[model samples]
Target: MLDNFPFYLGLLIIILLLIMLANKIKVAYPVLLVLAGLAISFFPGVPVIKIDPELIFFIFLPPLLYEAAWTVSWKQMWRWRRIITSFAFIVVFVSAFSVAIVANYFIPGFSLALGFVLGAIVSPPDAVSAGAILKFVKVPKTLSSILEGESLLNDASSLIIFRFAMIAVATEQFIFYKAAISFSWMVFGGVAIGLLIGWLFMKAHKYLPTDANLDIFLSLLTPYIIYLAAEEVHSSGVLAVVSCGLLLSNNRHRFLSSKSRLQSLNVWESLCFILNGLVFMLIGLDLPEITKGLEETSLMTAIGYGVLITFVLIISRIISSYGAVIVTLIARNFITVADNRNPGYKTPFILGWTGMRGVVSLAAALSIPVYLNNGNGFPQRNLILFITFIVILLTLLIQGLTLPYFIKKIKLNDIYDPVPRHEAANHLKQELAEFVLDYLKTNYEGQTEHNPSLQHLIQKWEQHIKGIDNEIISQDHKHIYLDLIIQQRKWLINKNKEDQTLDESIIRRQMHYLDIEEEKLRYI
Candidate 1:
């Protein structure tokens, strides 16, 4: 390998450029990045960049999962939990099992266990990949929520299957009863440990004399600590991180200050952005190495197998998605369900079509032990890598590219909201605003009369309540506020330029607050 610093620096620059191009052309960044990486690998003197399996599992997986678990709307997740869990756990199992059956039956000289290894590697869709692509497509809120919720759990479940399959491969034995017990322990125990850790961290944040940066730093540390502890106990580290994130996310306001919460969002955003970029580019960079690993299988033959497996995964997921919807329809009658109305077929179709393989699959393929306990080479390791790469390539190119068109074609109905969300949101805003205004007017009449700021706030809310439904008026009002914000920003920039005496920290703090105000406007 070349000097690590320059290689990564160059790769980072390429990723940024490719992302810009992706945005300009309305293509997913991962698609362009993959192609860019593939093209770069062929250039003379370019080093083949191989991501360490441990690095992906340890360094990359935890925080991304934690952040997603935390930031996603908990209400939405719970609303779709049944659908999500089925896709996350049951669908993955069925896909992996289906893949195993197909691989063992069709591929020559492969054991049931080896087939399962390949199955597990490719079973779960990559959350990162799905998310990146989903950004470009307009999906129903219900569809998006279900996909997001599934991603949080599927990673853990698929990896668990991977673990069991690997053990079966290594020992040439798998006892279902023992494996079931182990699986239960891994799931139940990991979640318990995560909840316990989250409680401890919650207490620490509440009691410790930690400032905003320290709070953000502790948040960063939480995921890594939870992941390591669970993995050390041979439990599901992925599940542990996820559970811990959920617990902390829901309870953060109880422990962290407002300033800490705001700052941590920016920190996590930037960190996750860099990580997503590097992983997408790195997925492309590993092409040369993966191709070189093939010995017994021809490139075309392995690709054929990959294409076959990709088809299997697609068909299985589609079938299982529909199955989940059907099962949910039946189950809701007997048990309480989040939404009992028929979800219709289009959303399920979208859910099924979006299972693109990504960097995680590549890493899982690479993570397969180089040699078994018997000291012989792992069966078809290079072939597995090739097939994984092919599956990733096909799915990214196929589903990732075609998703937007399909979404437009399908035009799935928005089941979550009967009324337009914009209308509902504004209606809710009016109620909340009116509630606050009444409280202030009732309790702080003297302050409202005496304080100019309080009087202005009351007047503004009164005006807003009157104009909230009038889009043209509200738009103009928003623009006025935004334009003034811009003037203040420009003045600050000029002031900073003109003077060297003011502390940069204070200037930056003001700038951050302005950003929050702007974001709040856009969100509303």
Candidate 2:
């Protein structure tokens, strides 16, 4: 570990520079990181980073999945459950089988089971990639929510298929009934374990002392604990982490202190940024190593196969997405009780186009055994790895870069502007303010002497409420109030920079508080 320190440090520095470049150029950071990694791969003496499949599945996947689960809005997820489930489960199966058939037909010496294994490897659009890319582009809230939800759930489905396909390939046998039973057990058991762990942790938070540091530490441990426990029982650890995160996130206000929430947010954001950056870059770095073992297949043939498979993957997803939409439409016509909100052609098109693969696919491909039970080499393992890498590279380069342009062309950002949401948010705040004021006046009108701070806070809340109400009635006042808050925040930041006597942390804390206030004014 110590020997690798310089290498790790150098890689991190490169990641940082790439991130800065990405931001400056207004491009997705992952795309830039991958490009940087690919360029560095050709440099003399740059060592190939061989990623262990176990490390990815065990170490990297849990926290990333949990963080996504925690941040996803449960309400929105539930609202879009039908669409999400269709994409997560049905589309995964469709894509897997479609890829399997196509691969078996097109690629020489590729068996159906081997094709299914490749299908499983590439089936799920990675949660991290989609989230990272979408963060930079403004899309419809429903579109974003559905994509997130699909990514969260699809891993479990794809991994299940991958496991069974691996078993079938190794043993040369496939049992549908046994696979179905195993799948059910894994899904339900994983969810049960996650709920239990989440509940236990929630109780611990409530009973334990309200120490923000300790709370943050426990929050970090939650995902790993859930994942390991579920995996130990042969369950879907991915679903376990996701479920635990969703449960805790939904109930965060009940147990987490304000400081814990604030600290945890900052910690998770930074952690995710570093992890995602390193993962994407590593994907590119591993390309050289992945391509080196293809002795039997020529590079030209491999490239042709890769290009053909990538096309099949994209087309399969597009067809499945539209087919699901049509099925939903037809079902709604027949059933009285169904979600009536129809996501038009544009939404499905975007969804189809956003199916970018990432690290998990590479990891799954790498995890394929080097040899079968009979001691013969695993059929086309090197070729599978190469194709997987090619798919990831092309999708990240082609789909990831083009998605922003498509969003703009469709006017998704303009359609889902935050203005209407802001108005609704302000209206809700106004009602909440009125209720709080009424409660305070009813209970503490004659107790101002006993609680001066309470009275002052009440006054501040009242003023804020009035200001928002005024802004709603008069549009010009909105800009005026927003500008004042912005100026105040800038003044505080500049003052903090100039003041040598003040502690930096103190200044930062005040700035953060001001930021919350400013965001509220600007958005609400």
Candidate 3:
């Protein structure tokens, strides 16, 4: 494999080309990458790609989860906490059991435990796939938030189930109480460790001597450190990375320099794309190997099983989604819910239809130990891998292709936020401008008399408040501008917490601009 570095490099070149082609053709790149890899795998002399489970779990999963945590709004996550948790924990558990029952009954020699192993591998919808497809279709903010938030945590829950199932299969026993206790510890313990580490890192960033480069390096190191710490204690590493990432993200302004924050974002964005792209391409490339590994079941039979289970996943998720709606409607009767009225079925159905599987399933399917603890080969390992591949390929194609249609046909009017996104953004800016103007006038009215830059900032805010061009400048007057930015940020932060209607993301965007402005004022 080391000697084949050039070949691997060439393959990546081809993968990037195919991705570009996918964009031009208006098809999702994951689908095309799979198709391209499949075609490449069949070519003479092309090595059958093998996935290293450790590589996927450690190298890939943590950073991806961390980036997602940074992007997702904490406020939104809290608002839709019930729905997100149900989908992440409840729906994943149900979906896994649904597959387990179906596989155990239908697949020859497949035990319920082994069935659960397969179920856990494939149950959680891949974050990469959902994010890719969501952009293609316009959906309600709440629905997208639910899906994104679910994807972040579902991986952790599914992996937990996968671990337990592997243990059950190895030991030929299932201890319900012990497993339940372990699950609790993993979830809560992971979060606790994450918060602890997050606080430490936050303080380090604030007090430690660090520039943009060092900050970016620490940002990269953060998820891996948190993940390793949590997993070392037999807790959920995925949750740890997520929780820590969210903590850092929320408090970024407190610590990270504006340049560091922006640079870190760009670096993570590129890294995520490369990692996800490589796996998607590898999915296509690994098919021939996964296909050839099957000895217990015929390729056609395995594919048939894959198709059957894929449908099962779809149906179960749809039912669970509707079930969630029903439960939400009922629970709202006794408890406080955002909307008590019978929340209709369209949104729930859309959520249900979006249960596509991807890279994690591929990695988990391959992660199955080739030989069990007793030395005999793992049963139906090839079949599992093949089915997982089929599920990924089929889901990416079927759901990915059809999601736009479903969204279009459903005619979803699920408007959780009455304020349009653009309008909300504009309103936020107006309020900020007004506040800044007041703050400047109140604190430094006479101080700006000799300072042209500060005066310019004040005048710009006044014109911006009047709906004129809002271009504002602040080059010199470093101390004055910095102080003013700090004051405005404090007000904006307080204002955001006070008004629930204003989108947190809009606040973040404004916060981001302030970061840039402050960075310039301080350094340049």
Candidate 4:
């Protein structure tokens, strides 16, 4: 471990540099990190990095999924439940079986079960990757919410299918009824365990002393505990973590102290950044190890297989997305209580196009057994790993890089304008100010000791109300004030983009100040 210190330190430095470069070039940092890791793999003195599948499933996955779930809006998730569920479960099943059939027909010795394994491996798109890219490009909130909700839950379905596939491959038996029962149990049990754990944790936080540091520490531990507890009972640990996160996040405003909430956000954000960078880079570094023993299959042949399967995966997603929309439209006629907000064609197209695979796919591929129960070697194991890696690389490079352009071409940003947001915020502020002034005047006007303070507070609230009501000065002055702040923020962002000399921390600090100023203006 001590001997690896220099290497780890150097890796951290490289990740930082790659992130800066990504910001300058307006590309997602994960893409750059993967490229950097791939480049570093060929360095003369560097040792090959092997990814531990267990580490990813047990360590990295829980927290990442939990953090994502925590940040997602539960209200939006409810509104888009039908769309999200269709994408998460139905689309995953469709994509998996579709790829399975294609892989079985195309690859010489690949069994149908193994094909399903590969399908399951590549079925779910990485939420982290999508979230990171979406952060830079402005998409509609509904689209973002749908993508986020689908990603949060799809892993459970994918992994469940993967488990059944692995069992079928190893035992040479498939039991459909038993598998269906087990799937339901896993999902429902996971949710029950998660809600129980989340409720217990919520009680603890509510009753405990309000120590920000302690609360943050507990927040970090929540995911791991929830995951382990659920998995111990053979339940879906992924669902458990996600459920726990959503429950806690939904209740955070009521139970958590303000300082704890702020500190926890900062802590989680930093942790996510480091983990995401490391995971993507690790994906690239593992390429050398994954390709080591592929002497049986020619590289070109494997590449051909990968390209075919990648095409299949993309096409399957596109078809499934539209199919889902059509099915929803038909079902809406019968189910009157369903979400009636039709997402239209463009949204589904964008959603289908964003199905880029990431680290989880690689981890699942790597986890494939080396030997079967009959003591024979796992058929085409190395080739499967190789193909999986190729799919990851192709999708990340091809789909991830071009998704923003597609969003722009569709004019999604323009469609989801911020004018309504500003209007609603201003309206809320005016109503709040008016309510406060009315309460003060009615309750405290006759009190002698509180008269002066009450009058002063009432005047302040009235002045704010008047300022909001004053249309002539309000519109022009507010616009100028907002414009100046926005201009300064843009300059800082552009400086960071143009010259890589400025530290990202400086830009982040400046951006934070601008955000605060903009937030303050919402009241006026």
Candidate 5:
């Protein structure tokens, strides 16, 4: 581990730069980065990098899961909560069972337990692929929300199911009732543990003196804490990390000071970016091991199974998505609890096409036990890995590459609202005005008897506020342009504060000057 650190660092830098360039071209960074890594692996002198499969799941998964959970807007997720819940819980079970049945029938030697393991491996939709695929593939905003929300939660569910199957295989005993009870405890226990930890950390932060560096250090520790705490109780660590991340993110202003906020944002963003880059690069680099697996099985047989399973994987998802949407609509029609707001046919179709397999699938496949009977190895491990590789490659290359075009053809992209620039500008103005008024009232009251100059300044600021207010209301037609002037004034206030060459009074004076200039610009 010590000696290989330098090689991993070099790989990280190369992959980060590649992803940065990929972002510029508006291609999905992960897809392009993985493809780039795959291309690079064929070159001479590239070290054959093979990571421990379990390491990827336990080490890499927590932060990636946390990042996705952190960035997902709670308000947006709440808007389609029911659909997300259904997809996460219901769709996961359906996919797993569907895959198990198909795999059992096709693979002569594959046991139902092993088939279920494959199902669990592929059941959770890839969060990385969802973000990457959605970048170019425009879908209805609500549909995209559902997909993202499902991806986030389904990871936890499928992981629980996967572990259960692994244990069942090891013990040569499968009990449906026992598994169901254990799964429930795993999920609830994970969530309860996460919330408990999050609360403790939040309370601890209140006593700590405000420091951006220290706050970031605390933020860095959160996911690891969540993972460890949940795992100790035989629960899903991924879900725990995700839950903690979500709780902290939603209550960001409560637990984190502005300085801490900036630091935490920077730390997590950089951490997630590097982690995402490494995962994708590793995906590409794993192709050599996959090719080696084909040596055991005949080339033609390997190709046939790969192609067949890939089809099953793709078609299963599409059918499930379509089924989900239609069922949801039909149920809503009967219940009348709310409007159908069916994002229409195109939204579901785009979703069906966009269920591309990625990092999680590969990680799960690699983690499959190589040895089952102590020293005796598990049968068909190579074939399993090969099939996993084929499925991932086909979905990524065939579906991911072409999903954007299909989305365009179907015209499901119109639901998204452009950024509310005008509202943001207006909001900034209101905040600035409020700030100036409060400062003038408090300072002028204190200084009026002693300082004549301060009194004059207070009177002038009151008039300035009124004039700006009138200008905003008078030019309704040009509110967008007027708001821009207010936006610039807000920026100047922030700049003056940053410069710190002036005291609060001096900054207020400068702000007044900017406000007047803004008013004149609004008129022009």
Candidate 6:
């Protein structure tokens, strides 16, 4: 490892600002940062910095996965367990085996074992990529949940397969029965370690009285605990990280105090952004190193190979999704009153197309062992990395850019409107507001004939309710009034006025309480 602190620091600062701009411009931050990094490579007097792939996986991935898992709802995730399991377990293994078939047939000098290795790495979708792109899209909750859950769980399955694949490649030995037994041990051992560690962590939090900073620090440590525990047992650290994230997230309400929850959220959100930026930038930077190995091959040949590999990767995913859908449908038919209905033909097709390759693919490609024994370089290492990068750029930059238009063409937009959902949510808010007002009126200290202001406020709320019932008030207009309420509350809080304008004070307090309440309302 080289220090080159000045160069690395300058690059990081530039990347941070560039990422912020990319977000405002509504472009994918990863792709943009990657492009910027690629451009940086050509600069005069730039020193090349080499990093170990092992460091990135061990140091960076756990926290990122933890952040994603923490924010997702356990109940919602559990509801989609069937589809998640199908995608994570079944889809991953199928995709790996399918890619192995294609790779063995077409790619020269690439072994079946190596093909399976590539398959394992590329099978899991990147959580960061999914989170980033899905942020701006208007997708249904079920679809979003399926994507996130799949992203989290597939990392484990992919790693498990990759482990076996690596063993076969390194030892030049392959046995289906041995591989199956090893896979079971790896997966179950990782899961058991995660559960035991998570339980211990939860119990520790109970003894450690909840404080904002303490909880935030603990939140940071939980992922590393899971990663280390799993690794100690030679299991998939990725799975352990994900499982621990889920376990801790599910118990946060019970173990972490409200203040601690807010602090932890803020901490993790900031951490995720920095980590994501660096990872994407690294992906771009590594492209130069990958391209260096392509000097011997003709440009046309390389492009042809890249295209063929990309096609195989893309097709494997699409075929696997369709297969999973058919199997799930058949399984559902046997159950009485099973609610796991398939989306209309169009939705599954749309989902199949949205399976874009990204960071996981890039990382896996680069992770290909560069040296084996007897002075021979890792077989097809550079080629694997090159093809993987090409596939990621094509899927993420090309298909990702076109996804919104595809959705529009297929009328997926009409199927996934936020407006109606927001309207229903607004109705719930109004009802809650009324409930609070009623409770205060019945139980509060102030009830007087002298207070004309109090009576006017009550009359205003009743009239508002009447207007809502009569369809005289629009949800959009009510949203505007809520904005005014927020502004008024902010002004009062800034002025440190607890008792100014009695009705407004009560309203402001209610708004403050609701602000706290809505912390639990996290969703796309």
Best by TM-score: 3
lDDT of 2 by residue, 392-505 (tens): 888888888888888778865443333444454455446545655665576556765666555565676588678632223223344533444445445545544564322333
Q: What's the lDDT for residue 52 in model 2?
A: 94
Instruction: For candidate 4, give the lDDT.
Output: 0.81
TM-score of 2: 0.87
Question: TM-scores of the models, in the given order?
Answer: 0.88, 0.87, 0.96, 0.87, 0.79, 0.81
User: What ranges in model 5 sit over 4 Å off?
Assistant: 1-9, 136-140, 334-339, 373-376, 413-524
lDDT for 375 in candidate 5 is 67
Query: Where does the lowest 10-residue lDDT sum fall in candidate 1?
Result: 468-477
**Candidates sorted by lDDT, descending order?**
3, 1, 4, 2, 5, 6
How do the residues 217-253 of candidate 1 rate in per-residue lDDT, one tens digit apiece?
A: 9999999999999999999999999999989876664
The regions of model 2 sitting more than 4 angstroms off are 336-339, 413-419, 448-458, 468-524
Which predicted model would earn the best lDDT? Answer: 3
Q: Clash pairs of candidate 6?
A: none
Candidate 6, residue 98: Cα displacement in angstroms equals 2.7
Q: For model 5, how does the per-residue alpha-carbon lDDT over 1-524 read when each residue is reduced to its tens digit?
A: 67768877888788878777867776677677778778878988777867577667777888788777877755557656777887787778787888788888998677888788888887776778768767765455556667777888988888777888788778779888988888888888888888889888887776767477877877778788889889888988877887787787766646665456555667888887778888888888878867776656797787788788778777877787788878888788667522355566766677677667777877877887778866667767788787777777777778777776776777644443232434434444455565655655664466567765555545544555554433322233244334444554555556444643222223334444554554465356
- Candidate 6 overall Cα lDDT vs. reference? 0.69
Q: Of 3 and 4, which scores higher on lDDT? A: 3
lDDT of each: 0.82, 0.80, 0.86, 0.81, 0.71, 0.69
User: Regarding lDDT, does 1 or 6 come out ahead?
Assistant: 1
lDDT of 3 by residue, 284-370 (tens): 888878888887677788889999999999999999999988899889879997555454778888899888788899998999999
- For model 4, residues 1-524, the per-residue Cα lDDT tens digits are 67878998899999988888888887878788888889899988887699999889888998899899887866667767988998999999999999899999989999999899999999988887787678678787667878989999999999999999999998889998999889998999999999999999998888987587988888888999999999999999999999999899767745776567666888999998888889999998888898786888888999999999999999999999898888888888888634566667887789899898888888988888899878999888898899888888888888889998888788664444334444544554465456556655565557525445444445556786876332222432455445545555545556546633223334444455556656556677
Error of 3 at 379 (Å): 1.4
